[model samples]
Target: MAGLACAGQLAAAGHRPLVLDKGRGIGGRMATRRVEIAGQACGFDHGAQYFTIRDPEFRMALSPLADAIAPWDDGGSEPRFVGRPGMSSLPKAMAEGIDLRQGVEVLALRRDGSAWLLETKGGLVMARHLVMTMPAPQAARLLGRDHPLVPRLDCVRMAPCLTLMAAFPGAAPRPFLHHSSGTDPLAWIAQDSSKPGRHAGLTCWVAQADPDWSAGHLEEAPDSLVRLMLPLLAKTIGAEPEMALHASAHRWRYARVTTPLGTPCLADEDGTLWLGGDWCLGARVEAAWQSGTALAKALTRHLHAG
Candidate 1:
């Protein structure tokens, strides 16, 4: 969300900003997992379930993507929105005119006089300005402990998440669209098939563990996690685990931000290296967009001034 937002704005400004991502697709945590079961194609939004439109800029920015976005009405106090078809649709749409290269991971980063040199999987690439939108912990590891920016990221704390994606026959009981509990191990569960624009051939559910439970079982194997989480989900939805057509688990090491940096972004004294993400503000898609937009605006202003 942050990377694409930053790159999209920079591209609109007529600056050819390049975005490199290690994942096979865009939308880091706002992801969708697609699968085929019994000749039925289904998808689960295993990452960000839904996003809110609190920021005016974010709401206006989504106007152009109104077709791809939909109101989710999760029965919450406030209105919520989600991307049509899947959560990744929003970022995929935002990346249309931008230069985004997937499956390219940066192994290391260094400053070469006026440019930033990046050692990637393919080869070394240089850039006049660098913007890192990865998780703070990951950015710290990549920049090393000796870097001056590493300490600033120390105040940012992110939590892990363990999610379960399961599917049953279409005849399965339809309990609720969404459920959340503060004490339950299965913190949040949603009837993903109930979302707009989803395939109706199967009943799909997405369950996410709370931060405390996720942290405790972060290192457990995926299959073992399925064994543990599936039963909880089945009990909640009044279904049997044996009736599941497909079941799987996904782990997000840095899923939610517990403590934020209290700033939109971090930058070097020379205005060359900038770091920002959802951790810069809070644990929301709007926050990531804000951080990325702020970084891009600051970087653009610095470049023009130089």
Candidate 2:
């Protein structure tokens, strides 16, 4: 989202930018999955469950998505907007007509003459300017082990998340649409089938382990993790584990920002190399978008001045 938002603003200003993602598709945390079970099309929004828009600019930016973005009445402090069909739909919408490369991971970054050379498994990519929107830790890795930026990024901390996606045949007990229990092994649980535009057949559920639990089982095997979580989910939601048609687990090493940068972006002395993301502001889609948009505007101003 941060990359897409930054690129979108730059493109709107007549500066075309290319986006590269290591994932199979867009929407890093805003992810979704579809599986076939018992001749049913089951879906799970395994990452971000929902997003709220407070910034007017974000609302304006999202207005074009129309029905793809809908108000989810989850009884929050304010209106909660979620991407229809699946959470990934939001990033897919933002990336419309933009130059995007999926399944390509940038292995390293180096300074080459007046441009930044990005080394990937496929080949090398060169750019006059660079904006890295990955997590602070990831950005640090690209900058090398002992770069000056590493010390500055020490304050930024992120937590991991272990997610379980399960599908149950027939009407599984849905005590609530969404529930968060910081004390329980399953810290957050959401009935994915209740979300708007999701495929309705089996009762789909997404459960997330709290940061502590996720960290403990960070390296656990997916099948083993799923085995450990499914029974807890069944006990919580009153579903039979044996009736689960599909069950899987995913681990997010940098799931949420525990400590933020408290700024929109960090840039080199020349303002050509920059870093920004949700961690720059807060842990929300709105924050990521704002950081990206703000960084683009800042880069535009700096370039014009140069």
Candidate 3:
């Protein structure tokens, strides 16, 4: 969300920006997965469930994706929007005709005179300006322990999350579309299939464990997590565990931003190098977008390139 938002505005200003991610697709935490279960294809929004646009500018920015997004009833006090087909749909729409390379990771970053030299598996990518949208810990890894952002990021605490994606055949018990309670080990659960444009014949559910539980079991195997989580889900949804056609687990090491930097962004003295993400503000798709937008505008002003 952060990277795409920045690149979009920068591109519109006549500057070409190249976006790269190690994942197979865009949208970062706004991720979705597809798996074949019992001869049927099922999708799960395993990452961010939905997003709320509190900023008028952010809402206006979503105009292009009005058709792909709709309100999600996540049992929240306020309404939120989710992408149709999957949560990644909105980002996939933003990336249309944009220079984005997936399945690529930056191994290291080095300062080369006035440019930032990025070392990737392919080769070195040098840029006069650089914007890093990764989590604080990952960015600190790339920059090393001596960088100024380390101590500040050390204060910005992020939590791990263990999510379960389970699918059952027709007639699976679904008492509600979504449920969340801070007291439970399974902090939140949603009938993913209840959302629009999903597989109708099957019941798909996504459950996220609380931060404490996720932290305690962060190193456990994915299959083990699934084995432990499915029964809890079955018990909660009034469904039979044996009826599940597909069950899987996804671990997010940096899932939620609990303690943020309390700033919109961080830029080098020259404004050529900027680091921003949801960690800069609060943990939300909106915060990530806001940080990236603010930093991009600052970059354009400092460099005067767009």
Candidate 4:
């Protein structure tokens, strides 16, 4: 979504832009998956549950895509938007006309004279301007010591999150409620099937462990972790989960931003490369869009001056 926003703003200002992602699909953290049980399929958004809008600029940008975005009704004054059909639909909508390439992992970035060379698993993509929307640690790995902009990116930090999803046969005892553990490993739990577009018969649940717990037990077996978590979930939701139709675990290495860089975005020494992400501003969909917009504006001014 951030890359698409940046590309949109740049294209509107008459500059060409391209977006590359290592995953098979767009929407970095706003992810969704299709799990089948007894020939029935369910769509679940296990990565980011919901997003809040705090910036007017981002709200303005999202107005056009409002039809695709909807209110989440999470007991907040500000409305949270989800993709109309699924979570990934919004990012796909933003990337409509842009040059987006998936399954391309960027390996290293180096200066090739006046231009920059982006080496990836596929091949080298050359561009006069580059915008990296990846997390700080992943970006630092690709940057190495060639880019002077690395040090400026120190303010960004991401925590880990372990998400566990399970499916049961019968209806849950009560409606979904967010659960927090005072000092336990689990931080939050939600009922996935309770959300929109879920199967009526199947009960779905999502559990996210706190940062400290996730870090400590990062290497634990999936079954063991699930066994340890089911009781807590049962206690919180007031029902014991039955047949485990769709059970899986997802580990988010860069789950959420702890402290933002405070800057809207970052640019290279030569003013030809830019960096933007949720961590650059705040960790949310709106912040991601804001960072991208800010980077696009900065790039526009830099290109015009040159």
For each candidate in the order shown, give its overall lDDT on alpha carbons: 0.91, 0.87, 0.88, 0.79
Candidate of highest TM-score: 1
Please rank every candidate by lDDT, starting with the best: 1, 3, 2, 4
lDDT per residue for candidate 1 within 19-63, as digits (tens), equals: 999998789999999999989999999999999999899999889
Would you give me the overall lDDT of model 3? 0.88
In angstroms, give how far residue 212 of model 3 lies from its true place.
0.4
Error of 1 at 67 (Å): 1.6
53-145: candidate 2 lDDT, tens digit per residue: 889999898888876787777666888877888888889998998999999899999998899999999999999999999889999888987
TM-score of 2: 0.97
- What is the RMSD of candidate 1? 1.2
Index of the highest-lDDT prediction: 1
Query: For each candidate, how many residue pairs have backbone atoms clashing (under 3 Å)?
Result: 0, 0, 0, 0
Mark the regions of model 1 whose C-alpha exceeds 4 Å error after superposition. 171-175, 178-182
Model 1 Cα shift for residue 55 (angstroms) = 1.1
**What is the per-residue lDDT of model 4 for residues 10-29, given as tens digits with 9 covering 90 to 100?**
88888778888998867988
lDDT of 2 at 24: 93
Residue 281 lDDT, candidate 1, scale 0-100:
98
Better of 1 and 3 by TM-score: 1
TM-score of 4: 0.92
Off by over 4 Å in 2: 178-182
In TM-score terms, candidate 1 sits at 0.97
User: Can you give the TM-score per candidate against the true fold?
Assistant: 0.97, 0.97, 0.95, 0.92
